[model samples]
Target: MRIVEEPFGKGVVVKPIGRLDSTTAPAAEQTIRDALTRSGHRLLLDMAELDYVSSAGLRVVLAAAKQSTAANGRFIVCELRPQVRQVFELSGFTRIITIVDKRADAEL
Candidate 1:
């Protein structure tokens, strides 16, 4: 997977393209972690172009959330596809993580 990062106000929008599986999760995690550090710990995950995610990907997301929380910063995820949303819902991540249907709804 390729991770694209762009500035969004005081935060950064990270878009992980392609599949986020075990083979790609490590790199994705590093990029996201770096983004959190660079963007003052504020991150918005724009998953509009993400094709798929695996258990490893979920772990990365959880780690990012934890990191942001520990820093007392913000972390939001947006634009989840139906299948991806189903995965998150079934995994109980929807309750713990901040998610929005649109990127505009994801506050920095």
Candidate 2:
């Protein structure tokens, strides 16, 4: 997976492409944590190019969500593909995490 970091309005945005599985979940988690440490909390994950995500990926997402909440920051996922969306919904992550259908929607 490739993680591209972008600066959003008041936070850091992470755009990850390719597959997010056991092999890549740690990298993703670390990337977000590093951003939080360096950039001061708020974060948004743009997942438009992401093709696949495993349970491990979900775990990383959950961890980030919890961290954001604890730190009084926001962590949102945007532009998820259909497959990834299904996984999130089936895993009941949709209820716990903020997910938007479009990047613009998330920006709002």
The model with the greatest TM-score is 1
Tens digit per residue, CA lDDT, model 1, 1-108:
788899986899999999999999999999999999999999999999999988999999999999999999999999998878989999999999999888788778
Give the winner by lDDT.
Answer: 1
Assess each prediction's global lDDT (C-alpha) against the native.
0.93, 0.87
Per-residue lDDT of model 2, residues 1-108, tens digit only? 899998886888889899999999998999988987665678888999999999999988898889888988888899988999999999999998998877677651
RMSD of each: 0.7, 1.2
Where does candidate 1 stray beyond 4 Å?
A: none
Model 2 pairs whose backbones collide: none
lDDT over C-alpha atoms for residue 46 of model 1? 92
Per-prediction TM-score, please? 0.97, 0.94
TM-score of 2: 0.94
The residue-level lDDT of candidate 2 at 101 comes to: 74
Question: In candidate 1, residue 55 scores what lDDT?
Answer: 91
